[model samples]
Target: MHEVLIVGGGTVGLSAAVFLAHHGVRSLVVEREPGPQVHPRATGVGSRTMEILREMGLADAVNAVAVDMKGISLGKVTVETLAGADFTTMSPSAQVYRDPDFTPARMRGTCPQNRLDGVLLGAARERGATVSYGTELVSFEQDDDGVTAVLAGAGGTRTVRARYLVAADGVRGAVRDALGIGLSGPGVLGPGINNVLFRADLRHVIGETRFAVCSVTTPEAPGTIVTIDGEKEWVFHTNADPAHARDVIRAAVGDPGLEVEIVSVLPWRVRAQIADRFSAGRVFLVGDAAHAVPPLGAFGMNTGVADAHNLAWKLAYVLRGEAGPALLSTYDEERRPVGALAMEQALLRLADPRLHWDNDPAMAAERARAGVVNAPVVQLGYRYGQAVQDLPSAEDVALDLDGSVGSRVPHMWVADGVSSLDLVESRFTVLAGAEDTAWASAGARLIDGWPYGPLLVRPDGFVAWRGTTPDDLPGVLSRLLHTA
Candidate 1:
């Protein structure tokens, strides 16, 4: 039996497999599609997601092909006066906020979905994950010991058992449905249309601008214009009826529009939602299967990627006997709120019509300050709250150097030219203050019986329990490793 079976081979599934394999756990991926469908969906990869990819050793590949989005441009086009509309370009300002220390590592990169999937699939394969394409999980049954899944594919049908199952099967997940978990929020909003995967020769019209440009059309038709895959590709997202979407796009671009080639037109609706629960028995949900948000801040895919990373390490610990089953409960507790917050932010942006620029001097300054300047906090400054803890007061929890537990583990320049993230591979890090040498030693003894290596790591990079001390290590470790 496979150690774990991941349903779907998209970004979340592939990322989970890669992380599990890197930590010496075997996993299998079952995808309905034969290969990556580089749809124009989810084009931006956030910085934290890139850091996780770097840990998986796939960052270089992603960075090599990604388009660096320097900035954004907003223009106003009224149906009554479309001829002489003013367009304002907004660039990144010098005043930095939100994790300025990680500035060198904090930038969003864009790659087509296909290219992103290719890099992840390659990483998963290299880490010894068995990826079976065009395979559908027909059904599954779970027990205390393991899970049995019936899969249907080109060859026919087969039954495979696994220790655990993770459903990354997008929005319409059979596993989630089978578990009787109904979607628990407002349904998708107005019928929106996205003209994805299309090609156009508008290099001369839009010029060398690489980042996304938002064009505010008349109230009759509002949409976003973007370039994808180094081509003049436009994703026209309209709030109007899908039937009238084409006409709206034609009107926005005007006649003699630089040779527009229509490719695939995908109709979508915005939904802000999360599953009732993240786990039931041995089954767990991740990615779009667990929660979905409007695409305003590009949080949908980024949050899913974070879910995979957070759960991978916990699963590795439990499977390796390094931690007890109680550790698994932290998965939903830590990640569910994050998904909720992201959804709230996306909904707020969508409802705020002022986000669409009006080109007024005051409006432009407000948009620049709110949209561009304060974006990093929404993108990265989220912190874990009561979801992951049972403490009565926040002071009980040890804060990172940055005083934010939800903030990413601060990236430090460790020795050997490697990052603090680079140093945290295949082990649980225990970062303690210099005064806590005794606490560090106490932690090592608790991990002696555990399966994985015990890293009695310090707040800095000094090892407090590398066979140097033996005073009350077990008690300290137990306290540090205890869960609510």
Candidate 2:
């Protein structure tokens, strides 16, 4: 039996497969599609997600093809009348206006969904995870020891056994349904349409700015026009009747004579949802299979990637017998609340009309002021309090000034010119202030008798524990090693 079985081969599933393989665990991935499909979905990869990808050895490659967005423009609309709106009223955008921290590494990059899938698939293959494409999961039965899956693949129907199963299947998860888990929260909230692909000339039609421009066609129809790969693409969310939405879009461009080719039209409903629970027996859920958020803050894919990171190390520990099965329980506790928080933020952003307006001088000034105070960090700075329950309190836990988790670790530059994220590669790390021989001895003892490698690290670059320490090491290790 394989050590782990992952359903779906999208961002989350591939990420998990790569992490598991890095930890010396064998995994199998079942994908319904023959290959990754290009969807006009989330293209902006935030700094935090980039940090995670850097650990997977893909930062440079992903950066090479990404379109950098320098800033964003906001506007407002009345029914059938587009007008200049102000952004200064929105706290999130206002923060960006003040600090204006736009470094190359920290800046956001836009990589189309297809390109992202390609990069992840290649990473998964290099890590030695077995990926079966065009495979369908019929059902799965899990017991105390393992899970047996019935799948239909190129060779036809077959049964495969695995120690654990992870469902990364997008929204409609066959595994979750088979396990009788219902998705909690509002399933969908109206229709949104996005059209993407290549076009010859868009610069002449729109101004040359590295910002995502928002135009309000009417109070009911709000649209965002973004430049991707030198082409102009449109994402329109409208309250108007679906039948007339396209007509409204055609008129807004104001040039029937302009030559524009439509590549793909994607119409989907926004969803704010989470699973009642993340696990049942030996089966667990991750990615869209567990939670789905409205694509407002670009949290959906990033959250899924974080889920993979959280679960991978824990599973590796349990399989190797370093930690008890109880450690697995922390996964749900940590990631579920993160998903809920992201969903709440996304819905809040979508509901705020002032966020989309940039034309009003008063509103624009307000947005600029708010941007200085509140930024995109709220979605990026989430932490796992549940995982680090034993962590000593230095200060009372409170949201950061930007409204994010205070205890959440900050991503800084790599100390020795290496990426700061490189420290987390393939093992548990304990970050202390400086090198401590006592902590090292404790860590070594814990891992020597145990199964997996345990690292005692510091907030800075000091190795507190190489693997051995004595004073209350187990208690420290237990608290630090818990996975999100």
Per-candidate TM equals 0.79, 0.77
Off by over 4 Å in 2: 70-108, 192-200, 216-222, 232-250, 353-377, 386-406, 412-416, 419-421, 424-426, 434-470, 478-484
Cα shift from native, residue 133, model 2 (Å): 2.0
Instruction: Quantify all predictions' global Cα lDDT against the true fold.
Output: 0.64, 0.61
How displaced is residue 377 in candidate 2, in Å? Answer: 4.4
lDDT of 1 by residue, 1-484 (tens): 9999999999889988988887788899999988676665767677667767777777778877766554432222223212223233343222111224552254334666667888888888988999999999999999999999999999999999999999999887889999998777675876655554456664554455444444546554566655464445656665555455555655555533445556766667677788988888888899999999887767899889888877887788779876777767867887888787677667756765454323234554554444321234444555555332232222211232242333454455554556554554546455433444464544422322222133354221223233224454555445434532
Off by over 4 Å in 1: 71-100, 103-108, 216-221, 239-250, 255-257, 353-375, 386-407, 414-417, 432-473, 479-484
In candidate 2, how many Å is residue 192 off?
Answer: 5.7
lDDT of 2 by residue, 130-241 (tens): 8999998988888889999999988899999999999999887888888889877877887655443424354554444333434445433455554455345544444445
